[model samples]
Target chain A: MFRETTVNTALVAILVAVPLVAQAAGEPFIITLATKVAIFAMAGVGLNIALGYGGLVSFGHAAFFGIGGYAAGILASHAQSYTPLMTWPFAIGGTQQMLIIWPVALAASGIAALVIGALSLRTSGVYFIMITLAFAQMVFYFAVSWPAYGGEDGLPIYVRDKFPGLNTLDPLQFFAVAFACFLLAVLVSVVLSRSRFGLALQGARQNVERVRAVGIDPYRLRLVAFVISGMITGLAGALYADLNRFVSPSMLSWQTSGEIMVFVILGGVGRHFGPLAGAALFILLEHELGSVSEYWQFLLGLLLLLVVLFAHGGLIGVLTRRPHRD
Target chain B: MTDPVLEIRKLTKRFGALTVSDGIDFDLRPGEIHALIGPNGAGKSTLIKQICGELHPDAGAILFSGRDLAGEGSVARARRGLARTFQVSSVAPEFTALQNVVLAVQGASGATFRFLRPALGDAALTGPARAFMERVGLSGRENVPASILSHGERRRLELAMALAMEPRVFLLDEPMAGLGPEGSQEMTAILSDLRHEAPILLVEHDMDAVFTLADRISVLVYGRIIATGTVDEIRANAEVQSAYLGDDA
Candidate 1:
């Protein structure tokens, strides 16, 4: 608890304080960067639910992320053009409201997860990983070929989408929105890690047979976790697309999936604030070292190798200086 | 005898050419310990798996509470008052002993889907879980992670988890495999007392514990039951003596 508390406090302070201080100094670019950190951290938190707690290494999480991005992108696009999303399906219209977009993103991602998880959960280990990756690629290719939403050219949002009472175009206000979401996501993860479902999911990760012997269906539990995990990542994707005012086919790509996994591994899988710590370190390295050299990804890869080989538990493990629990 | 709680009839399993279980018939009545004893590779673990639904029998019927268990998953079997402990000490390594028992308690209590509220603070789960740990002789070490528990303590923890299920029957495999003489004695005493609560279909190689605790002994040799009788009958039988009891008999 001590190690967890320390890491959590540091994460909350850095995530909140850094943005506020940067805003006070009138560094709007830093605020935007901070918002990216929060959004990506939220995405890592989503993966942690499946990978960290449920022990499900779903390599296709970008499908959910892309679906979420597309949910926001298509909705905002339709709203901008004053076109209805569907004429046959009850004349569904689009809106720039964050509240509406979030639920739609969650539903879209959750359903995709349900379908994918139902198939993938039947297989495990490398097979599960490959299946998830294959599904993500299928979505990526579909997004690439679907020309209506710009396909490979990507879709652009004319303006930053609206929240109920905030001017989303303002970087600081948007940071607040993303930061609030980041907090909520972390809160959800924390609560879940200590809840009955969390215990069962974690139990399934440790030993599926034990969970089954105890009368809990591991398949059903993993599927629920997978859906919730996708919904969270989907929400993060929506916020990310809104932040950039664009949604690209690459959002659904395998690289995005890898990056989300990197956030979880780099942060320390299963640690309370592992994703935040990992996301912060990753973004900082990308911004700092990335500008210093053209081949910063090589250094990033080397750092990740070092973390896997020696640190084992990622950034949070290094911070805690002790063996961390799953 | 009246109808047994668990009855297995003609249970058979095979891997292509090799038959691991061959027309096995077994039963356990309430308030009795039915010990299944045999040498290594005699399919004791396979038999347990079939009863617990971890492995499907090629041809057989497992009747629990007089209902056929065909097409039912392990979870369904478990929910219907069937509890099993692994030979390999299979409690969750990441959880504390208390947390492990609480999970078993929650599994039986039907609140497994509840999220948002902190399970760490739930009195409904923790209270009964603590009692189970106490029952299994793990009172003070409840907070220790299962990974750090001693081998003997892990077996006890597994027992605590089984008790938390409030099971109608217990399928215990190798419960005394690694216990020291004192630990074995203590486990024997616990099982002797536990039989009054629910019947146990125990599989073990510890003859001392079995001879002391068993109400009836079934000797399995080469995937086939060679003898089923009282402890005195099994000890006196020449076939059981030659096959499994060996020269010591």
Candidate 2:
């Protein structure tokens, strides 16, 4: 049996090594796929903070993901068209720099999460899940109907956003950026899970009454966790849109939320590298199984059912052979 | 003889057809164990809830340290040094015993917002938490997860958490409920020593524990205090005997 840190280190090594090997083999497509895994894993890491650590079970994280995507999409589009995003309100303009766009994306998603979490956290269990789902649906519909940023048709970026000291247009260069973000998100998740706030949040998850009895307001703790979670997922969304050079209402759809959740569940909820493992497995399955049959998702669904029924703690849990701390 | 640290004036709560709390006036003085004893369905639990701000009293003024607690919630009340243990031993089962106490210590310190420093590594939280665990006779079981602990140990863990808060009043609900005879004796010993740290408002079904530790006893029957007196006075009261103590005394 290996320590969890050993397992986590190996998982990170695999994620890094796979992309580097692909770049060496001149398989840029594989590098792109690995980059997608990094971005999606980053989103899963975000959702895990709220859903796993906080026990929030939010099902509307796609709203933050889409907000991040649109922040990049709208900003890059505005920059390309040589138009200001707003003429009034101090003449705000868009930028194509990833450095600038990342902050906008994070702030937008964080604010959205704050508003949604404030209202949604008032309810718990199934109601919390449903309310979050409903909020994400509202965002999806708004993106679909709004005419400003291509509405239902979606918006496209002609060029990928720029990051200083690197050529983001190169597949390996872009993977570096996404991989760095993923590592940072993982770092934040790990640090937060061990902190004082983490203890209270996890305590609130296990027993809200006990947490309140100890003089900590569980609501505020959860709200802060939710916001941080959304911000991380939002950053992933920005990188995701940049990867494909496009943003769409589909990014805000409930399917996206479910997919992000699958990554966490498949890897191991609350496990430090759970999302990364889950996302990697998901992408591998999608790629390998899709090439074999059109009904690849059917196989994925079966695997998910097996994981839920038998594995208990997902892939990491099965590998570690330890029961997850509830 | 001194001022009551907690004073409840005419606290009343009605669940539509039935009144759970019927204008209950209660108080806990400094440095004394005030035991609230009652039969099942006598609203002892309801009174505890109202005092701890879990349930809203229909009408009443709860004064803690001479300030009215009109609309404060459970968290606010707890922060103001009103510590309580549940009858069912509520704890984070996933957390280690030390972590549970550390959480209480952190809550008391009002620094739960610290996001980077690892909680277990910090001597400040773990130091007091470890001492509280030792105080409650859970010294060597610091690293044991709350779920696997024996029922009696969970009870002690809850006590350690309350103690870590450095509370002014201890609202202990049936601290001896599920313990065996030996476990109950140990708990009684621990609780007897605890009163020196802070006054206690004990709700218990175990008559032996109540008689042994209570400085004063208040017998509640059907949401009303039937008797409030010394052990001998309560034993001699005919109304209390028929209403509660009866053959059990």
C-alpha lDDT of all candidate models, in order: 0.92, 0.94
Predicted candidate 1 versus true structure: per-residue lDDT over A132-173, tens digit per residue = 999999999999999999999999999989998899999999
lDDT for A179 (candidate 2) = 97
- For model 1, the docking class works out as high
lDDT of 2 by residue, A1-326 (tens): 56677888898898889889998999999999999999999999999999899998989999999999999999999999999999975887889999999999999999999999999999999999999999999999999999999999999999999999999999999999999999999999989999999999999999999999999999999999999999999999999999999999999999999999999999998887899999999999999999999899999999999999999778889888888653
Scoring model 2 with DockQ, what do you get? 0.92
Q: Which candidate should be chosen as best, given lDDT against the real structure?
A: 2
lDDT tens digits by residue: candidate 2, B109-142: 9999999999999999998898999999998999
Score candidate 1 by TM-score against the native.
0.98
Per-residue error for B144 in candidate 2, Å, reads: 0.5
iRMSD for each candidate structure, in the order shown: 0.8, 0.6
If scored against the real structure, what TM-score would every candidate get? 0.98, 0.99
Candidate 2 TM-score on chain B: 0.98
